[model samples]
Target chain A: MKSLDFFVYLFIMAGVTYLIRVLPFVIFKGKITNTFVKSFLFYVPYAVLGAMTFPAILFSTGNYAASAAGLAVACVLAFREKSLLTVAIFACAAALIVNLIAMAIQ
Target chain B: MKYFKKGLHDGIPIALGYVSVSFTFGLQAAGYGMYWWQAVLISLTNLTSAGQFAGLDIMVRGAGFWIEMACAQLTINLRYSLMSLSLSQKADKSLRGVHRWITGFGITDEIFAVAMGSNKDVSRHYMYGLILLPIIGWTLGTLLGAVAGQVLPEVIRNSLGIAIYGMFLAIIIPPSKKNHAVLKVVIIAALMSCVFKWLPLLSNVSSGFVIIICTVAAAAVGAVFFPVKEDSQ
Candidate 1:
């Protein structure tokens, strides 16, 4: 793409992003009534974030082994209510080690 | 001035998170044939992971305007709308036009979570802290990654690339442990996503579509089954 085209695209994107983020606040102004909708909205972030994270961790390389190991480590740490940084470090370490072993065996 | 300090403190963790993640994006962009400057520019302008990845896809394919817009609006960022809505509720009651206006600029998932979790009043000072620190971290990380890409070995880059996913797993696993309902949602969403990836019939669908479907389906199911009590909010 040309420089101008890319700039235009970026501008449009930034505008659309801002609009999606800003519009509901301006329009709704405190009129959310449906219980189900409110409840649904409440869980969207967690669900969405989960959906985003899982496939990347598990299947990024088209295999389940490393991802599974990572998940296991993450679950243990998380169950203990470990800090976010600690859990992240341990999970990555577990995944990396599993991946290396898998690579070696192959 | 106060907003600036708040943005600083609130932004520090975010900045730490951003540097590591954006570093990978920078390396990827460079590996994909983008110039270092281009990678830096993308991080500077769009400071979002999925959106930048989608944008890279569009760039690689030389997609049209509509495709670019669709990919951006659909795939990477649709969640921000939810974040912003939740944020407005938590925003300081006394916040007025411009402060409220500028505050939304810093509303990334991590920042929003931290800011909303704060019990204190959401002053402009705090909001500024929430914003600036992450921007610095994200932008500088990208720049550093672009430079590092030339010198770093492939293995190191590959290993570091997993940091964000690790961060993500950290975020999810804790809450899921306490809330079976959240756990169910995570499992359902993951299984559905796997189905989308493995099933030949569904393989043709785009990543953006997968995100939309999985999010809606999982959230809807969770809403029906887990319904938050009336008094909990």
Candidate 2:
């Protein structure tokens, strides 16, 4: 990509992403009254993160079994409310072992 | 100053997680023949994992792929609009437009989760502190990973790929454990994502739009089924 073209794409990417976030802060100055709208916004984070995570995490590793192992470890750790780093490290370790086993099997 | 200290303290784990994932991203950029500086610029300007990965493909494909770059970016980053919308409810009105502009630009998935989950209403300085370390970790990781190109073993890199998803799980699961409604919404959204991935027509849609549709629909269902007390939300 030409230097100018690359910079243009970066501008668009940055501009679009920033606009998406800033619009809400600019628009909703008053208290939202509608129950459903309130409820919808309340649930948005969970829904968004969930939709982003599930099915996606399962396919993250090269092997299905390894990915599943990682996910299972994460679930159990997070269920126990372990700290984020602990959950991440153990999950990665679990996946690494499972991936090695899968490799051995292959 | 207190919240800035608190924000710095809270951001540590998130910064740690970003290092691994952005390291992977940086390695991929190097694999695409990006200079270390270019990869650093991408991480600095974009700050989005999914959007940057998609944009990097467009960069490598050709200059004519700018349309693909634009579409991929908007679709993937659209979730931030929803995240910021929710966060707008929690943020203090004292936050000026400039602070919103600064904070708004850095609202990644993990940052939004931590901010929204904070005990106090988010403040300007708090956001500055909260987003600070993660941005540094993200930019530094890319620079290191790009410069250290092809150094790590393939096995270790693949293992690190699981770390970010684990971080995502860590964010969602604790809340779900205490709140049954959150658990339900999470389950529904995940199931719907599976449907979107598998079902004929919907499966054809890009992953980004699939996320948007599934999130809105699932949250709507939660809104109907488990409406929070207006005051509580």
TM-scores, chain A, per candidate:
0.76, 0.89
Error of 1 at B170 (Å): 3.0
Global lDDT of each model? Answer: 0.69, 0.84
lDDT for A15 in candidate 1 is 68
Model 2: docking quality category: medium
True contacts kept of 2: 0.80
lDDT of 1 at B104: 71
Candidate 1 positional error at B227, Å: 2.2
Please give the distance, in angstroms, between residue A21's alpha carbon in candidate 1 and its true position after superposition. 2.5
What lDDT tens digits, residue by residue, belong to model 2 across residues B24-120?
A: 7898899998878889998998788888888888888767776677778888888888888888888876666777877888788889988877777
lDDT of 2 at B38: 88
Q: Which stretches of candidate 1 lie over 4 Å from their true place?
A: A25-28, A31-33, A60-66, A98-106, B1-13, B60-67, B70-75, B94-96, B113-127
Model 2 regions lying over 4 Å from their true place: A103-106, B65-68
